[model samples]
Target: MNIDQLNTDYGIPGNLTFATGKGGFPMIHIDNGKAKALISVYSGQVLSFQPATETTDLMFLSEKAYYAEGKAIKGGIPICWPWFGPDPEGLNRPSHGFVRNRLWNVLETATTADGATKVILGLKDTEETRGIWPQTFELAIAITVSTTLTVELITRNLGNKSFPLTQAFHTYFQVGDINRVEVLGLENTQYLDKVDGGVEKTQLGAVAIANEVDRIYLNVTNELVINDPALNRRIRIKSSGSKSTVVWNPWVTICANMADLDDTDYQRFLCVETTNAATDIVEVPPDGEFRLEVIYSIE
Candidate 1:
């Protein structure tokens, strides 16, 4: 449906509305008194979110991000599905799967009991998708906007055979400054440092960003906290159905090289993803499903 049709059919008066956003993509704007959020139906991505109590948004979006078709936006909670990172089969397919770039179907919208707004978007296997991964599956992302923002990603196997899957809610959080941010709950966890040739290392203390960092932390705790002293608030992340997590910041050198990000964009955001990556893959059985959920709240 077009933006007007979507608004006419699914919009909640004074709460949720649909309109054309950057790059001419259909966007969902939500404001239910407690918080405000923006979602892109084109990428099935949550572009921005902020509770009424906070002055700044919880998510970071790069101003230079590509809004065109087939290019993933530089920030927000991008859904990396079916597979994360490089193609496992060594095909020249896009990194982090193709779902992030495809348009999603809006399935349902509702107002929850506590006055929260919920939106569910779906994507099923198509001829074009099957041509890339050949897996028959259905994927849905149910997003709830309340005082706290919650996102749940559901994956169902439609084929008779089981399929291995690795995915992530690659969340880019906006911070006053990257240097003033320290991630808690990852202390003592072992991770594969991608920046250091994928060497195995253990986190000894709170994660602090001083330079380029790309690590897949394994067997993580259920809850993590981003203590942003500059922002003067702590963002807590609670996740379920995920044993692994990813922490990344493309610091100065790499930040200068990315076309979708400004040279200083790296200093304004931090990625502490909830994921099932590296060796923590899950196999979805035929007719069965898996869920990855995360809740974000600030204090």
Candidate 2:
């Protein structure tokens, strides 16, 4: 709980802000500004966010990709690949599957013997990803934001051979309304809709999230509930190695074409994603090493 090192000036100019976020871990390393807005401050609870700015900005505006950190909703932490949506098999070779536009390197961060405040983001297996799927891998992304905000996705398989893949952490949450919300523990179970596009629905009980709700819940064993009755609290969305769970709400024409979103920002926000991707891929094998962990509690 000692994460300080900021100096606002997203005004941009020669940018090279290193990165450091530990105040309690919601994220904020604006990297000398330039759209480095990972600003959640953990919870002062504002509304409109997305200030990452540039560095190739792959469209997720808060200001638009600042240092372009790994990826997060429109905030920070986005590492979905091989397939999370679209191209289920249409020349699937790129786009949203190489670790969010690729560019993560910040290996170790400290203080955690019960003090909690770690931050290790990494990715490897280059040479153009073993030429579109061969093997050799090492992708680690660990984040521990004190009170609440723990995102981890570690997969290592330095190729001896085996290395199957399919992942997701495309989580985009920022709610206050989204129709008052209701995602409590997926009652029935079974989802996979992608939009009206994939279609494979199920869960028909305690999980009300109105309109454009994309599904992808299969064999998932509980750990979700965004019942944000307008921030009264209740955002516990836990997950382990992963079984399957990807609920979304882009309603209202994708929030009016998203320009930083906020035509009511889909009422506020909801993109409960915690997946293993497509048919739940993760074959590690070779040197073996596969993991996925996400926690954002605020009950």
Candidate 3:
């Protein structure tokens, strides 16, 4: 469904309201009594989320972020589906699949009993998706905004055969200072270093940033807390149906080369993605479904 149809069907008081956002794409601005959020219909991406108690938004959006069709926005929660990171095959397609760069149909919207707003958006496989990755599938993202922000992506296979899949809720978190941030929960875990040709290494202590970091922690089931000393607050991240957790920051060198990111933008944001990558690849059976979800809250 297009933006007009969505506005006509499920528009409610203190729920998703249709409006044009960056790059003239239709977006849903939500204010459901407790929290506020912005979701882009183009990618079903939650671009901003802030609870009532916090003065700052939990998610970050790049100033130079591209908002045009088929271009991935720099920040927020970008869905990396069917495959994550570089082309799984030798096909040299987009880095994080094509789903995030396409329009998603708004399927449902409602206010729950607790006055939280819930919105569901979906996308199905067509000939265009098949040309890149051959599969019949249906993908939907369900977001609930209240005291905490919840985002869940559900994938269902529509084909008769099984298919391999890897995905991530590529979430960028806003922080006061990247240098003063410490990520807790992945300590004593082994990670695959993406910057060093996927070499394996074990984490020694709480993750502290001093330089470029790109690692995927394997088999993690713990809740992560971003301890921001500068902000004097902690952001809690809890997830389910994910085995790998990715922590990344471009630092100085790579940040300078990215067209969509400002050189100093890396200082204000860090990515701690809930993912299924490397050895945690998922095999979806015929007519089967899989889910990846995460919750962000302030403490």
**Models, CA RMSD each:** 0.7, 16.2, 1.1
**Stretches of candidate 3 above 4 Å error?**
1-4
Compute each candidate's TM-score over C-alphas. Answer: 0.99, 0.34, 0.98
Candidates in order have lDDT scores of 0.94, 0.60, 0.91
Better-scoring candidate (TM-score), 2 or 3: 3
Better-scoring candidate (TM-score), 1 or 2: 1
Best by lDDT: 1
Ten consecutive residues with minimal summed lDDT in candidate 3? Answer: 1-10
Candidate 2 local lDDT, 18-113, one digit each (tens): 334332233433332222224333321111222233122211233332333333335444667545665555776655565565445555654456
What stretches of model 2 exceed 4 Å from their correct place? 1-28, 31-34, 39-120, 123-137, 140-156, 161-166, 180-199, 202-208, 211-214, 217-245, 248-267, 272-299
> Using alpha carbons, what is the TM-score of model 1?
0.99
Off by over 4 Å in 1: none
TM-score top scorer: 1
By descending lDDT, how would the candidates be arranged?
A: 1, 3, 2
